[model samples]
Target: MRVYLPATFNSLTELNESGVIHARSGWAFAVTDALREFYTSGDEEELSDVAFDQAALASLRLLAVGDVEKFPHRRVVVSADVDDAHVTPVPDNGESVVRLEPAAVELDDVAAIHVDVPDAEEATAKAVTAIDAADLGDEDAELTVGDAQDNWLAFYDPSELPVLIELL
Candidate 1:
């Protein structure tokens, strides 16, 4: 899963370097402040803009499933304002807005899937079912992980991207 941050937050990259990001109020405020500075800056240095964009991308790369509670929408939306001479801008909706929803893989709906966490010393990696994670469906299904193996975690899913079921 990938997230796109606006090319305007400088301190985001620093947050990425600091592992084990906590879901604290102070951290959220820091992010908001960083973004505000980028959008409202009136300086000549373009490096600030570049740094902002880079930081956004890096934050997405380092995001964990546990961070979902902070935001209402887990999906990432990318917006760009196009002002090229070749193309004419629309009256109301000139900018391009793309919504990239989080790939939702149902634990019970999948045929076969695999999960692997080498760092996890325990036998099974603790995770939550898709339904439980986001209240997806009405079906009361319970799936199991780490049956009897080492360095091997498998489930029944049909998607290319690695799935991250909500950790229980």
Candidate 2:
């Protein structure tokens, strides 16, 4: 099973030092029955985008839980393939959230990392702080967060991990 794990540059650094993304039960987004039903007409690409977007949202929540100064204000997501036996679906609002067991993902398991570009820094920072408000139907906050999401993030192949770490 392939899952998108939302993270931050700080978290990536931790992964670099420890050589693992550790968790007792890590949360990720995947294409599950609910996601398929929600995007009834979505093709493979569209469904994949949906999963990525969900991971991006999860990144914002992760950012909110920490001191903003700890990392660059950019959204980061690591895509990895895990064994199906290690993943279980969580019930969410018409979406798929997966809980991963044996959650210590080695760097070797990551296929790629997607990171917001420098251009997205400002808006992404705002979105990081506005997530809760946006969730509560705050139109202005929603716009701020939406603006951030509109920016495209760059993708790095797993082989470029060392260079990516230096850049971060």
Candidate 3:
């Protein structure tokens, strides 16, 4: 997944000097720890703890592969480390793309509540109700089985969630 960075942090060297990246709370700190490990590898004098921290923040956008441009905003640059960074682009007649595997399933053990609603013949009402009744809020939910037109299947675990309806 790609995230956009601000215009100010447009260069790797600049970010290195500054030392930090802005990102969502949960994930950014882990990335910071990894960055600290990278910058503090050599002699103490050669590394600047403060600088490294700034660089980590400046690298708001990171790719599993280091292509900064792939991120949505072009204003800020992609950040890469010299030692571990891959310099060469993978071969594709400019058509090759990086593929990300589905993340490991880490569903919480919340009790799952399943409710069945009267099926709607048309896709539109069924889809809207299915999406709304699920009431996922900010949580991740999937319409696993059917599409918007045919049928709707929304699954939520009650252990980590409240009641969720699977509209047919």
Candidate 4:
């Protein structure tokens, strides 16, 4: 199973040091049946983008409640392939939601990461402030968050971050 786990910049530093990842949200995401139903016409890759977008929103949720001084405003999503047995569909939640144990994953298990870059911080911070309202079905708030997501994320292989960290 391929899972997209929400994370923060601080967690990435921890992964760099301790070599383990504890997803801030116990839930991860995937192209589940719920997602397929919600998005009736899309390829696997397109559905995967929906899943990744879900994780990015989860990341924003984390930032909204976390100590703002401690975590940077950027959102992070860790993409990894894990055993199917380790993943469980979350039907009660919205499309693409799933549950996965943090202990079952490690840095070495990751395939790639999608994160908002430095320039995204300002827009991301604005999105963070509106995520709660967005989740509550506010159309305006959803658009605010969606706008932030549509821009500024950079993709990286797990190996690229260590080198980019210093410069980023």
Candidate 5:
């Protein structure tokens, strides 16, 4: 099974140093049965993209939590293929929600990572502050968050992990 997990540069550094990283929230996204049923029409790739988007949004929510000022304000999504047995669905917890347990995501499982480009830092910072409001249905706040979400990303192969840990 393929999973898109939310991450940050700090976490990437941890993975580099330890050869493994765990999602702090235990939540990851994937194209599950619920996701397929919810989408009226789309190919497998399109469905996967939706799961990826959810993971990106989840990354934003993490940035908005406590100690917000301390975290680097950028979004990251780690794409990996893990054994199907490792993933468990979160019932009625939205289409893509899943738990990855025993929670250790080893470096070997990583396929690639997608991260916000350097130019999007300002917008991402702004979005971090507004995510809570956006969640509460504030239109203006939603737009701020949307701008960050729409920012282009840079893709990196897992082999570049060392360089990415430093550059990000």
Candidate 6:
């Protein structure tokens, strides 16, 4: 199964150095039965995009919990192909979140990483700080957060992890 794991630049840097990501029942996004039912009109590609979007939102939550200054303001998510047996579906009221048992992934398991570009830094920084307020329906915070999303993340092959970490 392909799972999208939310991450930060700090985590990515660690993965680049150690060639591994150690997670504990990690919260991730995947195409689940519920997701399929919710987006009944969506084709496979569309459903996958929805799953990826959920991962991006989850990354924002991860950013909100961490020291914002310790890493770039951008959201990062790693996509990997793991055995279906390792991924367990998580029940959520809204989005499709999953749990990866023994959530440790070697670099070899990673397929790609999606991250915001340098130009997104300023808006992303604002979004990182405004996440809570935005969730509470603060209009200003919502705008800031929305702007950050406008700076769409770019995908990079797993082989580019080293260079990406250096840039971060």
Using lDDT as the measure, the top candidate is 5
lDDT of each: 0.25, 0.80, 0.26, 0.82, 0.86, 0.81
Model 6: CA > 4 A from native: 68-70
Tell me the lDDT of model 4 at 92.
92
Question: Which lDDT tens digits does candidate 5 get at residues 44-105?
Answer: 99999899998898888777764333346878889989999999988588899999986889
Give residue 100's error in model 5 in angstroms: 0.8
After superposition, the stretches of candidate 1 with alpha carbons farther than 4 Å from their true spots are: 1-44, 72-168
Tens digit per residue, CA lDDT, model 2, 63-95: 877734556578888888888898777866437
Writing each residue's lDDT as its tens digit, candidate 4 over 1-168 gives 888988888777777778777765568899998889987798999999889988898888888887444446889888988888887888799788888864447888889877887787788888988988998999989898988898757889888868755655
lDDT of 4 at 114: 78
Candidate 2 colliding pairs: none
Winner by TM-score between candidate 6 and candidate 3: 6
Candidate with the greatest TM-score versus the true structure: 5
Lowest summed-lDDT stretch of 10 residues in model 4?
A: 65-74
lDDT order, best first, reads: 5, 4, 6, 2, 3, 1
State the lDDT of candidate 6 residue by residue for 75-161, as single tens digits: 888888989898878766455788888788889999999998888879888888898999999999989988887777899999998
The alpha-carbon deviation from the true structure for residue 24 of candidate 6, after best TM-score superposition, in angstroms, is 6.3
Tens digit per residue, CA lDDT, model 3, 70-163: 2222112222122112122222311111111211111221122121223422432333334433335522212411233233222234332212
Candidate 3 vs candidate 5: the TM-score winner is 5
Winner on TM-score (4 vs 5) = 5
Q: Report the error of model 1 at residue 168, Å.
A: 25
What's the TM for model 3? 0.15
TM-score per candidate: 0.19, 0.91, 0.15, 0.90, 0.94, 0.90
